[model samples]
Target: VLVGRDIGTVVIPEAPIKFYIDAAPEERARRRYHELKKQGKHVPYEQVLADILRRDRIDSERDLSPLRAAEDAVRIDNTGQSAAETLAQALAILRAKFG
Candidate 1:
């Protein structure tokens, strides 16, 4: 289920799997910082961190579009995991469900 500020509350059939991908605020900040740097855009790490924190606060505290995971949604913490590891875990979940 794709729930966001742009998505309204509408019930839809055939909703089998729903996953909300998330990362730590600091980790996101760091990734954003590096991506910007790679593009030759100069931005301070502190600024990136602040921007990420601000986004988190707004997302969590929003009245109409607050960010939250569904009760039955599986939470995956990719904080310290590599991309390959995360992908493997997600694939494993799918295999278990379908196989």
Candidate 2:
């Protein structure tokens, strides 16, 4: 299970199963804020949000290996879900695809 922004799109375009997991920007910012706090990093929530947006824009706009979902990738929107829930959804997709 390789995890990267461009794994499915660039590194391994022929992979059988690819999941593009996403969430709202605000939710992502909240999660990042908590993560940074857990690591003892002192950063404001608004600043974290701005950084996220800026990084997203840069990633998507970059000429090489831009961030994008592969054409055949399974898109998952886990805006308000826990990690376990997201895993369950991915597992469900695998089961349905292989069963």
Top candidate by TM-score: 2
lDDT of 2 by residue, 1-99 (tens): 999999999899999999999999999999999999999998999999999999999999999999999999999999999999999999999999998
Candidate 2 versus truth, CA RMSD in Å, comes to 0.6
lDDT, candidate 2, at 66: 93
State each model's C-alpha RMSD to the native: 3.1, 0.6
Model number with the top lDDT = 2
Q: Name the regions of candidate 2 deviating beyond 4 angstroms.
A: none
Off by over 4 Å in 1: 1-14
Report lDDT (Cα) of residue 68, candidate 1. Answer: 68
Any idea what lDDT model 2 has? Answer: 0.97
Clash pairs (backbone) in predicted model 1? none
For candidate 1, the 10 contiguous residues with the lowest summed lDDT are 5-14
